[model samples]
Target: MEPKNNLRSLDRQINVFLPAISLICILCIFISCNKQDRTTVIYGKVTDQNHQAVDSILVVAGGLWDFNIEVVKQIYTDENGNYELVIDVPKKYIKLNV
Candidate 1:
């Protein structure tokens, strides 16, 4: 009789935790699905008109919105004349300058 009673108690304990565990798993799934990574990576090697790699060049991206210069991003070229810009794109068009 004692063994049977203990088994029942253990089963009830497991049942109490099962719903909470399942809820936690469902919440995790929703959180991971709702997150979005909204960014763009622009990369290239800068070169002069003579076709030589131009190092230390300054790259700038600008935008106009509502008659104002809304945002500007700047990055410098690497030693190998490589430049990369990770930017958040809010609109369809971007103007880049070197």
Candidate 2:
């Protein structure tokens, strides 16, 4: 019957399109997951209230969540009051902490 033929055609069409749609969705997820963030380091100089270098100061870097700042790295300032904190940021946390 015509109705049976139409049903089979519809089923075939769905079977073909479903895989394509699924592939597209998987590709999108992979593309989004491949976010780039590696060369991101927090660096700054510690200065005192009197505009003087604060050597040996503890510099702390953190990844801020909704209501918490998880400590990522910490370093001490050098003789020049300069510090560098290395960290790896993920995509779930917006690639890096603000």
**Highest TM-score among the candidates is held by which one?**
2
The 10-residue segment of model 1 with minimum total lDDT is: 89-98
Per-candidate clashes come to 0, 0
Residue 43 lDDT in model 2?
Answer: 85
Over the stretch 1-98, how does candidate 2's per-residue lDDT look in tens digits?
A: 99999999999999999999999999999988886665568888889899898898887766656666777677899998988877776434432442
In model 2, residue pairs whose N, Cα or C atoms come closer than 3 Å (at least 3 residues apart or on different chains), thus clashing, are none
**CA error at residue 37 for candidate 1, angstroms:** 5.1
Candidate 1, 1-98: lDDT as tens digits: 99999999999999999999999999999999867564767789998898888889988766655555544578989878899888875654344332
TM-score of each: 0.49, 0.61
Candidate 2 error regions (>4 Å): 1-29, 91-98
Q: What is the lDDT of candidate 2?
A: 0.77
Q: Kindly provide the TM-score of model 1 when superposed on the true structure, using C-alpha atoms.
A: 0.49
* RMSD vs true structure, all candidates: 7.1, 4.7
